[model samples]
Target: MSQFALLGQRRFAPFFWTQALAAFNDNAFRCALLVLVAFQLGLDDHAAAIYTNLAPALFILPFFLFSASAGQLAEKIEKTRIIRWVKWFEIAAMVIAAVGFVMHHVSLLLVVLFMMGLHSTVFGPIKYAILPQALKSAELVGGNGLVEMGTQLAILLGMIVGTTTMGAAEIGPWLAACITIGVAVVGYLACRAIPAAPATAPELKFNPNTFGETARVIRITHADRAVWNAVLGISWFWFFGTVLIAQLPIYTRETLGGDNTVYTLVLTLFTIGSGIGALACEKLSGKRVEIGLVPLGAFGLTAFGVDLYFARHGVAPVRGLGWLGFLRGAGSWRIALDLMLIGAFAGLYVVPLFAFVQARAPREKLSRIIAGNNIMNAVLIVAAAGFGLGMGALGFSAAEIFFAAALLNILVAGYIFTLVPEFILHFFTWTLANTLYRVRADGLRHIPEEGPALLVCNHVSFVDPLLLMANLRRPARFVMYYRIFNIPLLKFLFKTAKAIPIAGQKEDPAVLQQAWDAVDAALADGELVCIFPEGALTRDGAIAPFRPGVEKILARRPVPVVPMALRGLWGSMWSRRDSALGRARLPRRFRARVELVVDAPVSPEHARAAALEARVRELRGDMA
Candidate 1:
């Protein structure tokens, strides 16, 4: 089914709108308060800074303190009913905000902000946990993409509305209050339509001790390396986003010299870029839960962040120009563009990480895992604030700080990717294959997560192995021709992947021996080893008769042999028939929808070359 079909279904749409509207209201109220404290109350510069920073701290504080309790609530109760109660609380919080605004009471407003944060903290686990319950596994990525896109756009609109309404000449406070209350009401109504989501862990007990429960939750999450890594990835995104958003006002005033226009512009560009990047996940991921996009996002974040620093440094500050004039200004435009792209890349970076966590976490404990993620996000955001403060104390200009942040991003991203090589490896292969041609896969579940498995497939493209490698949940060692393994541009990739290179006996006896030994060692270590039994690209666009070498390899180890097929690769550049000079050439962009169909695993005793070949051919069907 298509991704958007989820939106039309009863299970997802109401909750999606409810969450989006709540996000919108939260930002609108926060921005309105910031404007009031900055301009209407006649606060000093330092006081305004404290208020702005303190607001986020106060809001996020609840997650750290109450997330454990919230997680238990989500796991133990019906999610739809819990969400209904959360929405009612949102209404109560908004009512308080409206009162505070009308009274021009800053203290009361701060209290309301904290209350709102607490509301969100209680809703956090349910927000993510409900998705897995409501949507199918395949729909997770697209559903997350839509949620992320809607969220960023909502944040942008809320900030625009809040700042605009707060700065109005007359009745600004009243107008802000009315809009905030109205949006809250709409959000509550949306929540009312959410379909029932049964409790994942009905017997889960409540734990009130914050730190103890937090530690327990972390311990449980750590049992699954992939899920824990994804949680850390999500936390890092919050760190990056917090730092960027925190600097915008400074970036606007000091760098661009526009009052509030530049502030809104930067925020809008970043948020919109994020939205675009988020939506692009569906296309880039090929409608799968592609965690590879996480590393891709990190790369873009650092790349664009570095460029933004340089771009801003090169720009001569525009003294009096408004937002439009600043955009038209000579170097300033580049900085603007850089900010937008950085945000876009960030969107690309974070959405899939969230989906990966949702899809991989144990079903019963998903809510607690999400709660743990929220707690970590809160911690990272707080750390980001401190980092910014430290940078400022060292007498760094905002531009210099931006550069420092960009450099730091490289280190952090590198560290995360090192801890999780799958992300970087997946990014590499996905980028290579997607850029070269459309890829499709089938029967991927036949590839065992552990133990020795020989994957025999028809070779149709130079990148076919990489595509298969990228999609598999576990790392795989591929046996390839010596020359392709030595290709200069792809040399580092092959080395990093530890791909085994082989040659025919007449060409290179030592290389063939090395290849065989490597395959044996990999299988002995209980790792998956994939071999293109065809040994070369199909010259006639048909499965070459299976070679006896596969039979020989299996005789030694007697491991499971998974029969697989690749379709729609015959016309690819590497296909023997497609080459103009009897060599591989680049194919058209996204033209073919390739598929990898994996048949049931065949035991070594029963596996025969002809039998495996015929089974694969049947799965490949008329596509070949």
Candidate 2:
């Protein structure tokens, strides 16, 4: 099903709207307040600057102070109940904001702003932690994509609505107040329809000491290296985003020489682009939590970011140009394209990392991990603010700052990828599979979502592992023939993937023995291991007899065995079909239609080698 179909489901739609409405109100209220301070109140430039600067700090402060406690609360209490309470809290804040808006009470409005921040702080952990419970494993990516797209669009609309309404002279603040309050009430109503999501760790102790619990929660988040890095990747996205967004107003005014309409236009472009990219993740990832897109996103951020600088580094000669006039100017389209693609890539970068954290973190500790992620995000946002301020102080142009951030992205991405080669490996695999074949995977749900499993597949070509790796939702260690494992160009991929290189007893006894030990160990540790039962690639379009290697491994470690078959790969690039016919292999079937058919896993005791070979043959059928 398309991700959009999720909008019709009770499990997802209500939560989606509740969160989207909250996002709308948050941005709406903030934008309205800024308009009041900057234009309506008649504040001097210095005073306006103080309120503008203090606003973000006050809003972000709750994340640092209460995220840990909020995470615990999410874990300790039923989530839907807390969500109801949070919505009511929002209504109260909006009520206060209503009076503040009419009375021109800046202090009261700021207090409401802080209260909204606190609302978000309390909701942060539940936002992510609840997904794993509400969604099927296959639905996680699509669900996250929907949430992301909704949030981006909601934020954009909120900003436009808030700014436009508040820009009116006399009735503006009243209008803003009514709208915010109405949205808050609607959000509360939407959240009421959210089905119950029981606490993951109801028995867990609730630590009231903020400092001690904060450190402890962070420690839990960092317990897994991969999970922690994913969190860091998320934080870096915030840092990059904060810098880019913080500069856009100045960039629009000074660099683009445009008025507020142009600013709105640019904001719309970025937001719409991000929403498109967010919605695209479900299709691009094949509904899996594919992190390969993260690198692709990083590359786009840098490439277009640098190109953006060269597109228009100098200030435009014309001043006070409206959006239309700006768009008609020289090199304007390029700048617009740069901004849009940057937002698009930002969407691709973040959605998967969020899904990855949700899928990877322990269920009991997931809320705390999300809380810790919030804390890190808050710190980075503050740092981004400082970086933007420091660059402005050093007299760097907005375009120059964009250039610097793009360049810095290369370093940050390289560092992160270096620390986790799996990201690069997945990128390579995902690229190869998507480029070489249009893969249709079926019966994949039969593979256990968690725990140990032995996958036995009919090996057809050299790229079989890559295809399977790309399609499998869960990571699996592949066992390949020793010679294929050592192929010069492919050696790094195999080694990084931790593929076990196995040899026949006659060829290399040590290698064969070592492979057996590794297979058993991997299964014992609750990992998935896939092996070719044929032991070598088929020379013709036929299955070889099943070897006893699989049976031997099962005897040692009796994990569930899944039989998988790859079809339409016999004549593909790396297969032996052409070589057997004494002809040069060519790209005859580039982007060939391929199928990966998996059968229900057989219990270890009944998973005989011959039966599995028979099952795989039936699955492959006459397709080859």
Candidate 3:
């Protein structure tokens, strides 16, 4: 089985069920209480509205109040132990929920909601931090995707169960109570299967004062711009979700003229879309934490959200239509479809931000940083609620609100792209190259993290430099021939990349001197400089003899030399041997797989052209 398959591994299954069960129980209890107050109990409309609003507030409140302390607990204790304790807390919360249901007490139910929030608050840091420990580095994206998909599915099922069961007179509350308790027990069992995840920061000092510690954690997040940016990205997702979910009841009742079923259908579609988008992350990202998808997701959100606004304008209010009836209604299905696609794109937009935070944050304080993120998310959600209410008060329709949010998403995404140019730049390059060809890279770890290094690869295809550029985390200055460097369409890219251009000694001595000086300067500044040591692309798909100039440059810098080989690029349309006159007759759809094999780094004293060539040949193996 593929490593990306969640069910194939013990490491992920436990945590997956644990998180899904928590989401299900939380929503089930909330929806059941809302149903009782709104329908069976015959509460006043104003009171019901207050209850509905307060339900979310109570649920989100603990994330702000207790997340800082929870972060501390997660950092100081083994995650498995913390998770077990949290599961017990869930069981207790469910029991309290059962009492609330039995007594028909609104106050008790509200209190239970708050308690569930607390349960989730304590689990938040552990939920994210545990993955980096339990999963392999490459599996992080896929694991996060599965967890997200499962959580959204759980939300959908919970809503369905809560709404359907609450209306039954004989077994409504009893069924809900049984489901809640059973799910909690199952969660506890799943927690038992989780392998031990030791605390990353056992020496962390715990503080009881929530406000002060919370402020301190927020400060730490702000100190790292990348982490804080990711936090903002996550918070924005919650903001969008809060608006979308909050408006569902209003849209279903006032706009669609439908009952509870329509509300549930809308929620289900949106959530299912999110699950699909989350699952797509693994395949789209090639199992890496690809931030490039964030921009693509942002684009889709704006496009579909705007389309959904227009779609909603065409939906007529329904009267007592079942699921199939609703699907057949004019524009109702289109609206639902748009909502689902918007949600899926939103998932695509957010999952990478989460992975980015986990991969990039200081491991010692990841929990606290995640706690800080929770605080921001809570604040943003509250802001979203306020924004929606304000918009409604100002006579804006739900469709208009969506339009405004979608437009605002464009501006916000633009600002973030500006702050992190790499996000947009990398996204552009990665999308283009990945769509055009299948790229396989090996021995990428040979690239040193914090030193000057020389990378020598056999040039094959026109895009070889770009393939290497995209996969390697470090920025490299490629030394290219003058003609290729000045290629009409690629010159801007080369200039932006600061590629060095050289000519032969007899052709242009001045250009050659400038190239040498640029290479020396880049190495002195601790940059990795790459060159096709074969001098030019091979004419017949064979590795050319190693050029001696690379040795001379390495001798001056005395840095490590990394040998890399590019495979399966020989037959590409962009290969040097491709006939220019016959280019129009080339195969229309070339789907070749290319691999970049990086051999172990060799020190200047130990490496020569012959040694480097031999190592490259070995890494290439059959392809060579």
TM-score of each model, in listed order: 0.83, 0.98, 0.87
Candidate 3 residue lDDT tens string, 1-624: 254576667888878888998899888888888888888777889988899889989999999899999999999999999999999999998898888887788899899999999999999999999998887666778888888988999988988888778878968888888888888999999999988999988998899999999999899888888778878988988988888787777777666767767777888889889988998987777677788889999999999999988776534545666667777777767788798999899889999889888887878789989999999999999999999999999988777788899999999888887776656766777787787778777766678855699998888877887787777756689999998898997787787677999998998999999999999999998889999888887777778788888878976778888889888777667786556556622435755567888888888998888878777777777773
| Model 2 weakest lDDT span, ten residues long | 580-589
lDDT of 2 by residue, 47-132 (tens): 99999999999999999999999999999999999999999999999999999999999999999999999999999999999999
CA error at residue 510 for candidate 2, angstroms: 2.3
Instruction: Go through the candidates in order and give the clash count of each.
Output: 5, 0, 1
Among all candidates shown, the one with the greatest lDDT: 2
Q: Against the correct fold, how does model 3 do in TM-score?
A: 0.87
Q: What is candidate 1's lDDT per residue for 1-624, written digit by digit as tens?
A: 666777887788998889888888888999899989999988899988888878888898899889988998999999989988988888888888888888889889999999989988998999989998888665778899888988888888888888889888778998998998899889888888898899989987788888899898878778888788888888988888888888777777777777677777788888889988988888778666787788889888888888888776533445655788787776877887898899889988899999888877778999999998998888898998898889989988777777888888888888888877767877878777776656666666666744688878878776778878766655679999999899997877787787999999999999999899999999998888888887888877888888777888888888999888888877677667746676665666555677878888999998888888788788888897
Scored by TM-score, the top model is 2
Query: CA lDDT of each candidate?
Result: 0.83, 0.93, 0.84
**Per-prediction CA RMSD (Å):** 5.0, 1.2, 3.9
Enumerate residue pairs that collide in model 3: 256-317
> Which portions of model 1 show Cα errors greater than 4 Å?
44-50, 314-318, 440-456, 459-463, 471-563, 568-612, 621-624
**Candidate 3 ranges beyond 4 A from true positions:** 1-4, 314-318, 440-455, 471-531, 535-542, 547-562, 570-593, 598-607, 618-624
